[model samples]
Target: MPKVTCHNICDAIAAAPLPDGMHTKLIGIDGCGGSGKSTLARQLAQDIGARVIPTDDFAAWDCPLEWHDRFMAQVIGPFQANQPARYQRYDWHSRTLANWITVPAGGTVIIEGVSAIRQLFRPALAYKIYVETPRAIRLARGLARDGADAWPMWQGWMAEEDAYVAAELPAKQADLVIDGTQPLAAR
Candidate 1:
């Protein structure tokens, strides 16, 4: 998808009525790899006093989809139960499990990553945001971030993401679509 320079994205978010503090709300931030989905999710969480749970922490370097069960068990289940939940973080460099992180209560949680808004988790999300960026730009960003050593892997990941999104229809299901290449307005 081509990146749109619409400043209205955050404006729309701001205009929406804030959810009551009584319930936990999950915000799924979905996009192609290195498309600024994480950045936007973090900023939005900070702006709205929400906590961010990055899906990158769950995905393995070689097998990103393998952590779905862990994600559901640790994060989603606890949040749905209205309790604090802890999840083991993936060590991307070591390609192993790392430290465990806890998800706290009382605020919206931003789940940010490529498959963060997958069909299995859609019902659990209070709102979904799709970050639309150009494929060329996304590929450039991914390669730059991951380095030349992982270029082929990155390409494969991109193809996998394309196939997943096509089958899942996350963009069509999204409550909001943001052009992540644009700068967010200063609060």
Candidate 2:
């Protein structure tokens, strides 16, 4: 059940039954910053041969959740139709759309990001996963990865995630809750 948060959540997801009438199993990895959403997504992708779509491709420092329209139009819509999808990847350093990426049709997909399991995505998802970690740990991990110079940006992103959580209730609505603090090998 979703309430049973644990490191072995990936195993649980693999064993769970998917909904019928879909071309692919759509999985979402959602969590606050440094909660290991992307890490879990990567692990799941490797485990299931799924393409991991990092929400970072669409995210920006000032507007963390602004990629909703592009995601819907590019990824979700095409996936639902059993058609390949393409997205213009956003370059973090340049702060611009740099390159394009493609997702093949009829394959498993793991979408990881702050709002990966936002309400709008529920209808298409086979499994809505929420990764939970302590705020302090999350912030530390984020800062470590993005560097200390990006501390303020991380804070702003966390604040945006906080608001989204309040409004969307992603954790409560998820099909699985993962203990992201755990090691991937153990998980």
Question: Best-fitting candidate, measured by TM-score?
Answer: 2
Off by over 4 Å in 2: 1-11, 14-20, 184-187
Clashing pairs in 1: none
Error of 1 at 140 (Å): 0.8
Candidate 1 C-alpha error for residue 29, in Å: 0.4
Model 1, global lDDT: 0.78
For model 2, how many clashes?
0
- Per-residue lDDT tens digits of candidate 2, residues 1-187? 3344334665666665655666867888999989988877776677667888888998899779988999999998888887887999999999999999988977678888989988888888888889889999999998889899998888788888889999998889997776778865533
All candidates: CA RMSD (Å): 3.5, 2.5
> Worst 10-residue stretch by lDDT in candidate 1?
1-10
Q: Give the runs in model 1 whose Cα sits over 4 Å from its true position.
A: 1-22
TM-score of each: 0.86, 0.90
